[model samples]
Target: MTTEEIRAEARGQAEAHLRALVGSDSAVLRDDQWSAIEALAVDSRRALVVQRTGWGKSAVYFVATLLLRSRGAGPTVIVSPLLALMRNQIAAAERAGIRAVTINSTNIEQWQPINDAINAGEVDVLLVSPERLNNPGFRDEVMPRLAATCGLLVVDEAHCISDWGHDFRPDYRRIRTLLADLPPGIPVLATTATANARVTADVAEQLVSATGEQEVLVLRGSLDRESLRLGVVRLRTAEMRLAWLADHLAEQPGSGIVYCLTVAATQEVAAFLRDRGHEVAAYSGQTDPTERAALESALVEGRVKALVATSALGMGFDASLGFVINLGAPQSPVAYYQQVGRAGRGTDDATVVLLPQLEDRDIWAYFASLAFPPEQLVRQTLEVLAQAPGSMSTVALETYVELSRNRLETLLKVLDVDGAVRRVKGGWVATGEPWSYDADRYARVAQARQREQDAMLDYLDTDRCRMRFLRDQLDDPDATDCGRCDNCGGLTLSSSVTEAAVDEAGAALSRPGVAIEPRKMWPTALANLGLDLKGKIGDGPVEGRAIARLTDLGHGQALRALFRADAVDGPVPPPLASALLTVMKDWAGDWTDRPVAIVGVESASRPQLVGDLATGLSRVMQIPVVGRFAIVDASVAPGQGAANSAQRVAAIHRRFRLEADVPAGPVLLVDDLVVSGWTLTVAGVALREAGATAVLPLTLGTQT
Candidate 1:
């Protein structure tokens, strides 16, 4: 058959597949979708589809998979990013009569069966997270087989493969290796709804065949979502934002998302909304996998009014979510666009509101602090790994390094991608390959991030069409005034929250106290650091209480003010003192034993506040002030408190000594703040060793 005749036949099959996939008798593929499908199935070329959400990007791949399989090609391998996305895709694939299975962290037990089915040619599409591609077992055993036999490779959320993208993941870089290993002429497709000019170019460049045998077909389109009505509500206080959400959430279109910048905010906002009779749930990275799935289902099925979430819910969660309200602005316009894109996907009208507060920049700074470490620190990490005899676990490496667990893990991933390290079954090992720190590249990225931040600020204050402004930030060539946004028309939402709602929100915020879960297990291999600690912390403090989290919406703001570097070291404020009394009262009410005395943890930064808190509590509880732990060695370096558990433990082990006499029985341990909790742990252990029966920890704030 002629090429045109063959294209016509393939187009007919694609329409049939599209109809089956959407369960619509009259459904047909868009011209762009058909173009992507044809490139993948007929031309066997690489394709990148950068279109708006709900624009049928998935249809292109699913249809292409069926077309390729009809000619006896192997099952398609989809490198998806999130579990929610995988679930959505699997369901969609089933609707199209395609067999789809997934192997993710959640479904480990099913991996063998899934692999067997794939090998038996019973699975038409196998979805796996990008992280799984780097797994030693999967990479060594399954990936090569899949790469050799796979008909088409799909990289969903392809923008993540580029470090220039708003939401970059190191694991996505593993796609380059997979691409290189693919059999010659195998088709590849990468799709994303959120990528600007830079990210698009980076992703498209990454999609080029290692052999230079095929050029990628780039299909870019407008990112305008016509159903979205964008607006911003500038609230002067976090309390006001909470109040607005409480008073106006139910009046919005349907059940939606209330996005918060921090996990503490999610919990606080969800709790406040629920107290106001809204059926909302809090979600964050700290939530368990099972609970996350259930919460996603709840939001999708409309079982709850909304899910107060962090960016953990940002990526491929599919539902006809009616609205998305940001309690705080994301750091960049790109991130804000990706998040707001979640709304109005399947509806003719959806509300997208951004509640920008003064605290948003502080939150952004906190996240920015976790970026790539300095060159010196990177060198130190490499030296530690190089000097090691075998693969070192992250916890073990933490003893010698000053980085936190999260930062250390991230650095290791970047190093691995740079070929300076390798991830093995046991842990990570130095690759012994010469690697140069790309200072210029990293600086450029950082500068780009700053520019994005500036653009987001511009977006918040822009008088032009909000949608158009965002699209322009994304380099959308077809950006135009939507005539639906608040800026284009008038303010779509009211800044006025009822007095009663404000008071209610204030009361909720005023209520403080977050449980401080004590450390149960010691950092592994402390012996390497000249400390003998290992295994469970048998003598550690029991569960403790903090007046608030440093990230909390209510008392947290005050606590943050009190803990700022430039803040005066004064006695506890009257309001915080009163809240502390309430916390103590509630805490004592549930205790099996009352504290016989108060002991203070040594405070280098807030000695006045910690000492004052201990004395005030002593007077209220009618207990003696047993005295405080002394800083035996004040020689520790600055910022040592923020190090990982092992380092913090080692630092505290040498610095803290119980210099005061302690009468037995339970005692209340007070501190200005609990960061790593190692200071409290060490104090608790020392007190327990000094004959205290039990130690109860109480702090003004806990750094989350």
Candidate 2:
């Protein structure tokens, strides 16, 4: 048969497979989708597909898998980003008679069986997270075999492979080594719905063959989602945003997602919405795997109005979501596009609204602080690891390093990818590979991030066109005024919320008292730091109460303002004083033993606030004002308590001594702020040793 005749036959088979996948005889692949499939299956060429969501990107891979397997090719390997995405892909593969299996953190028990199935050639596709690629067992044991026999390699959410991408993940960089190891002529496909020209070029460069013999076919298309009607709602306060959502959320077309900038906001918003008669659930990275899966299922089945989520629910969650509302603007326009893309996938018309808050920049700044640590810290971490006798677990390393657990884990991943360290069975070991910190490159990346932030600010205030502005930010050549957004003839949502709604939301938020669970177990390796502490803390403070989390939607703002670096240290304000009294009143009702005395934790900063809070509480509850703890060493820095658990514990251990008399009864231990909770714990221990029966801690706010 002629080449055209063979291509026609392959196209026919592809369409039949697509029909089966979508469960519709009328289903057909778009022209570009077929081109991607043809490039992968027919030409055995590398391809990058940059199309909008719900554009059948998965169909291209599934159909290509069937076509390639027909010619005796091995199974396809997909590096997916999210568990929810992997679950959806496996389900879709089943529709087309393609056997798919996944190995992720959630399914440890099934990994061996899945690996056996792959070896036996019983699985047509194997899905794994990028992090799994770095797993010593998988990379050393299974990856080699799979690489040798892999028919096709797919990188879903390909933008993650580029540091220039908005959601750059260090684990995604491991793909370069895998690509280098793949056999020649193996078709590779990278697909994402959110990538600008810069990110696209970076990913395409990574897609090239190690020998530089293969060129990647780049297929870019318009990023305009016709079904979306975008708008921006400007609200002055967090309560106003909540009230607006409370009043208008049910008016949205269908069940959708409500995205929050932080986990605290997700819980606060979801709870408020539920109270306002909207069925919603909160989701964040902290959620358990089982609960996350159930929440996803609930949203998919239309059992809930929306799932208030963080970026944890961002990539590859498949649902016919009809609306998306952002309580606060994302840090960048690219992230905003990726999130709003989740809506309007199956419906012809969907609502996409952004409620931009002035506080959004504060959230952005907090995330910025978590970026790659400074050079000195990085070098110190490496030196510590190099001097270790053997492999050290993260907890063990934390005793020597000052970084938090999350930040330390992130740095280790980057070091592992850079060959400066290697993850072994028990823990991580120094690789002894020569590595240099690229300060210039990191500076440029930081500057680029700033530019993205500026662009997002422009997006919030732009009067031209919302959809077109987003498309232009993504470098979509086909961007044009959609004439469907609020700026272009669509109905604009009102920022005006009912007074009753605002009052209700404010009341809910103002009603403070977040439970501060006591740390039962001491941090690992505390003894190594020269503190005799180990195992469970014997006399820690009982479960305490704080006015709110520093990340909370309501009281957090006020507390943040008061705790600013330049803010003058003064007595507690009237409003906070009233809130404290209310907290004590509410707390006393549930107390088995009322506090007979109040004691203040010595504060290097905000001493007035701490002392005033304790004295006021004592006066209101008619309890005696006990003496406060005094700092033993005045030379200790103010933020010594902000380090890792072991470090914080060591810094504060024996640093304070009870200066006042203590009655033999429960006492309210007061502080201005609680971070790491080491100060309270140490102070509580001292007070207990001073004859107090029990310690009930209280604080203005808790920093998470």
Candidate 3:
């Protein structure tokens, strides 16, 4: 597209005020962002921003939408990552006091409200999920009503279109088709945080091939959160590991989170910590919906002081909780970022203490054992979308080749992620009829896709920077060490090789109580390097065995390693052996600067409390340090709160709870993960009543 062509998409009046509105509100756009936006606005060349956390991506959409709207531009249809995100954005717009509406799977009737708004010429933005973009609801009732109203189409978390993204959702792959179907020349925009080379290239491909446009504006902010300090500890044994956690917790202020890889581990840790006097709250898949809500409430209401949970804690969770204490090594860097991101929403410094525990494989392997069969998925999808018994709906199967729905609800969801199928009476019917069908090809493709998924399991076994490896598969070929990632942070461990970190405690312990670290661990080791903690030797350790690495370490070992490897003070703890590794293998094809903020805090003068845990030893250290850790009151240690007080538990669960249920002045929703986004929608509605002006959703990773 030429400059003139790009200008034509937005009316002349829109092009004038766009720049000013680009970074306003909670959008937080930076310099690089402007460069990307400018390049996109003026040049025909493709420009993209490969940003990380804290980088404003949604601002780009809002700016563009507002710009186009100024010129009497039609509505901008944004392909939301989740229903929750759409609701959040609506809440934000309402909070901003801007009239915006969205429709999703849960509320098909929303189409009426949205259509009414479009007809009244009252809506500025139309947020829809990709699945909904091609749905009968949008095509028949919504799209035709707003066809002339929609000027621009935006795909949030565009990386999900490709299998390479951290959280790939099949439905995103079909977004390009929907764009292609839209009346010619409608400019399409997309944004994402977790994009690598493969994903980036995919995005470019999507813009060119699917949308039939060469000028796609790609704007990204930085990836670094410098205010958040980095520290890595090699596991010795379970006993030593637990002791090390005790010591690390002793040094931090506010309640912290300890993420486990398994529900059993979460339960065990919570029990152990509770017995040890820490107000430990546990959350896992096993916890019912009510219990989960209670747990979330506990964190927000300031009921519990500390929490032990599995990956369940990171999904759309919003809390200014003080610290993120990791008891288990995350399966991926994306997972790690999200679990830790819950802590630093406030301006106050917060701490994310990562204690890598070799995870138990029984859980993930069990997941594999329970994975739904491809054939079943396909058949169920067809069944749900079957037309009403009396009448048939002509829906093209090829158009939905890439749709995604909740696995648990695969049988119930007659439509795709977009909610297109219309249920009249007993049977169901969808809009798009099968364009062409090669049953053989469908079967082959289905199986091949299943095999491709096997690659994720393989990813778990690879020795590369988990983040880099994932991005390369999705975005770029030249992508290398993102300098800020764990791999770039100087951490490296090959899955093919088995080498134990230094075990000599005497050498690591320089002072009587202080542990002399072998070498300061690079960021990569903190984020990558899968170590087996359940006590297995050789290749067996690579498989999910709990090789008892840190927990087994005796008395002399635990505190010493804690003082050496985990402590981030004075200077470097261990000599980074991976400097050569990083220089030689540089996984990140290119280095993208990340957003960073740092501030100083005076040490607190308070007493530290250490305790004996149930069947374990737990100690609570007074709030001594407060950096990268947010706590309302640092003085109260973990054990100070009631063992079962809802207020106390709520405080501890705060990491997963929203600050307020009501919306304030155009409140923006900030989250690390975007799944179905329904959770965020619930949050958005809650925020609205609480006085939030409007609400928008910001997610680091969206399964678009």
Candidate 4:
């Protein structure tokens, strides 16, 4: 049948399915969902699902599967990133009287059901995790048989496979290759609630085949979540922040999800909120799937009015939520979107509030550190694929190694097309995957290629227009500004922030080539380093370079001269001069080493908090007032260029009238934020024994 005719028959079947659902009183779905079915008909084969986290993205495909059930197109294979998500989808499908089964690492034996269904042409759908989907059995044995007989290949959390996606999973990298293994001419329907334009393109490129124009189609929806109101707040202490959250719920009431960065924090916040007389529930990775299921049921049915959670909930079930609050700062826009979108499940109005502490930067940096392993991963895979025997296809490579921790996943894919290797029958056997090589010469070539990608990542880390940086790397260099990013909102960035006017521009090698001190870099740098920019030089590696040599030709007039001569990833700042300033100021002994607590961020009726703190230090200790200070995220980020973070923090220290409370060693403390009186208390206790004049703390956020 033609694609459209097939789509029509499928829709008719789906309507019957939904009608059966309504008769059984299974769900309270709206008419818009039916409209979605028609829309699917018009755009039959390829699909794009744009909905909130709880909008039943899975339902759309499940309905499609049932619609096409009569055709006897064998069983549909659903690929989900997480094991839990696959199970959830399977469970929900089972509830609707649909025949569904799942298999992951935990139950590899259950995969026989999938093979049985494909052979009998009876199973409607088989849900499996991406990891399990590529297992030796499914890949070499099960998949080839189900190829043309398969009905549909539903890819869940499709964004995760996109390298630019926030929750990029290493396993998801094999998605494109897996798609190639699907049933011939079977419709490919992909769904993700978190993909941006950049990620969308990545998805298409990876899935694009040697077919006509419709190889992979794109569908987009407005991200302007009208029911959600967005707000940002910066704070210092957990006690005050929890209390504030409690008050917020008291006023906003109903049901909400409070997302915290850690399991312990989620537990603590849940307890703290409960003690304050708020109905609260907490979910973490530690919670078993059954307990998680119960909790999800509670929130959906409104038994629990609030839930404090870590990022553990699977992405399959549906819910109508009221509010989504960020209890701690999120690491990236993608993560923020997923959490915030958990609210506003299409049936209700939802609000999103963000509570950020400067320390959260350190927390995010900690997560970024995980990507470090991908470096060794790429080189090793290339080497392995280069030598072996047959075709070096991703599936072949996957069979040899349990997992690919490879760094350049995209490049490995590119090599597959460039005739670097051929696709052999059983799996990939390498044909040298050869390159110009005199062993050492090839090594140099490999290093150069690595540098090229490194330069791109550096651009992501150290360039302005993070969105543009990513777009450029993806080959859509001319794409317009993505309106949702922090950059589009006009936040000045350290990446592109030039010295207002550089009179003495090209003067390099002036300052000592010291490693940048990375403590608390100004928000400008941290925000700048956020994922959109690619190339990033950690403060640690930014030690005095062997010497700035022109890659093309050596000498130039301004710093731009160095930039223009030969393209390099980074080197935008001087070392942290503030540490020296701090040392110099401390040696004078007028400043307190201990910090005073700051209750208010802006001014208050009572001038109790440290206000003239910077002026006081400058006048008393005679320190330079460089006026280059900016807000700094106090959280320590070991994943960052330590030197970069430290230098920026030092620069921040010099400029602003920060709320500082230092200890009383020989000097008074100067702190910018005081969430509670604890920092002050600690500083005061330290200062009193040391015999310093005082301890003070400073901050700039929610006053009352």
Candidate 5:
């Protein structure tokens, strides 16, 4: 056959495959789509695709996998980041006649079978989560073989690999190690819809093989989502935002998402919306894997009005959601854009709105605090690891170090990258390699975060086109005024809330009391810290109640104001006092008996507030203000040396003493805030030892 005829025949087959895959008769491939597939399947070259969401990025990879397999290539290895994304990819691959299987935390039982299938060449594509890249079994047994023999390697949500990316994860950094182990000349593909120019370039660079003999083809596309009608509805208070959403959600085009900054807010907003007669659900990292899948399916099938969520539902959601409303702005515009991108994908029009809150910066700071551990702490961890002769389980190390569980795990991953430690069968072992904490790199990252924060703020305040501002933040060369947005098109959301609606929202917000789940067990490995504590906290305090969470949308603002460092320590505000009474009345009726007296935890900073809360509650409930738990030493202040459970228990171990005779019956213990719950635990212990029959703890708020 002639060369031109052969080329035409190949293109014909590719087009026919696309038609069958999309179930469309006129499924002509875009130039960029064809280019990406040609690079991966024909030229056998690495490629990085930076396109908008719903732009057929998955089609490129699926088609490439099919074509590569047709030529007798082995199964493709896709390092996906989320279970939802993996599920969607597997379904799409199956539709294209590319059999796909996944190995993720949600499906361990299928691993052996999937591995067997891969060995037998029965699976054309295998999807694994980014975190699985470090799983002991997968990393040591499966990854090396896949690296050597997999037909193609694809990194979905590739921006996650770059620290500069808004949603950067330490787990994704393991990809570089995976890339290094890949045999040369294996065509690789990295794809993401959120990367700006810097992140795109950074990720593209990582696609290079260990030997650096091959080049990566960069394909960039405009990020403007024509279907998204972007806008910001600035409300004076969080209650107003909730009221507005409750009033307007029914007016949105289709079932959508209500994004929140914290898990607490997700549930709170979902509840508020439900009370307003809307069908909604809450989704977050806390959601169970099976439940998360169900929730995703519900949203996809339009069974719920919306899913109030955190970033856990931010990415990997494949539904063509019709609207996305942000209850509070994300810290970065890139992050915001990626989230809003979830809407209007398959539809012709979708609404995207951001309701920026004053508390967003505080939430941002709280999360950022966990970003990179301090050099001193990192070194302390390394020193401990080096001294240990054998692998140290994370639980074992937590007792020695003071970081929280998640933070500690993140630090360990970073250390592994720096060669200070290695993950083995039992746990992690020290490599004893000389490693310097990358102070400059961390500082740069911190600065980048601050810059992103500033950019987000600018996005909110800019009178220019909203979409244009976002596009510019992403370094999109074709960024122009998206006429669909509020700024450019003179569109504005109705911030109007009826008086009745406002009153209802205010009542909902003012209604206080969150169940403070008592600590049932002591942190693992606390004995290793020489504290002599182990297992369940046998006589630990029972379930307690707090007036509200500091992150709550309604009472949260008032509580935050009262807790502010600059606020004068005084009596509990009348509104909070009223809320406390309601909380007490609404307290679980299962309490065997009413409290006999009020005992306040002494606070150096909020002495007046804590004292007044105890006195005020005593007067209202007619219970005696028996006595205060005197600070034995007052040397270790609350929250000092309380980063982790062991340290927290140690700090407050003997810190409190019952000042006088305890009440014979249940005693109502009070505090300004329940941060670690250790204070309450130790104080309850002291009371129980002193003679109280039972303790029912009450607090103004619970820290996030």
Candidate 6:
């Protein structure tokens, strides 16, 4: 047979397989989708498919898997990003008679059996998280075998592999290494619904192998989603936003999503909507895995009105969702487009709304601050690993460095990519690869992020069609105004909120007293840092209270203003002071012992605020203001780089001296903010040793 005749036969088989998978006899593959399958199955070439969501990207893989497996090739390996995505893929694969198995954080016990099944050819496809690729045991033990035998490799959500992508993940960078290690001539496919030209180019260039510069079949498609009717609802305040959602959420055509910018907002909005008689639930990274699965299922089955969520719900969750409403804007237009694509996937028309707020920029800035740590800290971490001979767990390394757990994890992934460190079962070990900080690359990535933010702002304020602005931001070559958007046709979405609803929302947010759990143990690394502390803290402070998190919905705005970088540090304002009284009342139930004196932790930045808070607490509770703890040497005080427990404890210890005599009763410790909680732990230990019966730590706000 001629080459074209063979290709035609393969295409026929693939379409038959696809039709069977979707359970519809009329189902047919689009031409571009068929091209992707042909490239992967017959041509055996690397491919990158940049198509909009619900465009049969999954079909390309499932059909290719069927063709490849029929040729007696090994099972396909899919690097998926989210558990929700994995769950959806597994179900879809089963429908196609393809046996799909996953090894993720939620199912560790099944790893051994799954590994055995893969080895025995019982599983047709294996789905693993990007983080799993770099895990110590998986990387060392199973990855080599899988890389050698896997018939095809699929990277779902390939945009994450690019540093310039809207949601760049460090772990995803390890895919380049995996690609380089794959056996020769194995077809590789990467797919994403959200990559622009820049991101698409970045990701495509990274699809390399031992063969060197493999030709990637770049399949680009138009990104316009015709079913979505996009609009924006601008609100003057957070309360009004919540009220509008409560009043109008049920009016959406079907069960949908309501996106929030933070976990605190998720909780607050979910509660408020529930109070207004909507069946809703809060979904974020904080939700348990079982609960998240149930929530996803509920949304799919139309059992709930919406899942009030953060970006945790973003990635590859598959449903015929009918609408999406953003309570606050995402920082990037590309990200906004990806999220709104979730709606109108299965219907002719679905609503997509963005309620923009000035506060959203602050939230965006807080997240942006979590970008790659400075070069000094990176070098310091590398030096620590180099000096140590055996593998050191991240916990052990925390003794010598100051980065937080999440930040440290991110940094370690980068170092792993640079060959500066190796993660093992015991922990991480120095690779002795002589790595240098890529300052220019990091700077370029930062600049790219700023541009994305500016584009998002432009999207909010544009006089043109919202859909067109989004498409242009994504470098969609066929971008044009969609007559469906509010800007194009002037739909009647009101900014006005009912007074009764606004008042109820205000009351809900005003409810005070977010719990402040006490630190039960000192950082285990403290002993390694020459501190005499180890194990559980014997005299740790009792469970305390914070008026609110700086990220909370109601009191958060005021606290954030007070803590702004340029805001003048002064005494606690009248509004925050009044809120504290309510917090005190709410916390009264938890206090077993009432008689106490107040003690303030001296602050170099906010001396007046800390001092005034202590004094006010003393007056309101009728307890005496004992005294303040003064820094013996403010010059040596810990810097912001000391974000971990051990570093924070080491930096702040012995710097503060107790100025007042210890009272015989319980002591209330006051501070402006609580982050690592180490400062409070050390101060409480000192107060206890100084003969105080109990120490209760209180703060105006707690960093989440």
Report, for every candidate in turn, its global Cα lDDT versus the true structure: 0.89, 0.90, 0.46, 0.50, 0.87, 0.88
lDDT: the better of candidates 1 and 6 = 1
Q: Write candidate 4's Cα lDDT for 3-62 as tens digits.
A: 878655655667667655434534543444544544443444555554445555666777
Q: Which stretches of candidate 2 lie over 4 Å from their true place?
A: none
How many pairs of residues collide in each model?
A: 0, 0, 127, 73, 0, 0
For candidate 3, the 10 contiguous residues with the lowest summed lDDT are: 609-618
| Model 4 lDDT on a 0 to 1 scale | 0.50
Once superposed on the true structure, which residue ranges of model 5 sit more than 4 Å away at CA? 1-9, 490-492
Candidate 5 least-lDDT 10 residues: 3-12
Q: What are the per-residue Cα lDDT tens digits for candidate 5 across 334-433?
A: 9999999999978999999999999999889887887888889988998898899899988788878889878899899877876788998889988989
For model 4, what is the alpha-carbon lDDT of residue 192? 78
Count of backbone collisions within predicted model 4: 73
Worst 10 residues of 4 by lDDT: 540-549
Task: Name the candidate, 1 or 3, with the larger lDDT value.
Answer: 1
TM-score of each: 0.98, 0.98, 0.50, 0.54, 0.97, 0.98
Q: Over all chains combined, what TM-score does candidate 5 have? A: 0.97
lDDT by residue for model 1 (484-514), tens: 9998883468999999999988889898778
Off by over 4 Å in 6: 638-642
- Which residue pairs come into collision in candidate 1? none
Residue range 215-262, candidate 3, lDDT tens digits: 555554444444343344556555445545544454455655678766
lDDT of 3: 0.46
**Candidate 1 lDDT score relative to the true structure:** 0.89
What's the residue-level lDDT of 46 in candidate 3?
Answer: 41
Selected candidate, larger TM-score, 1 vs 4: 1
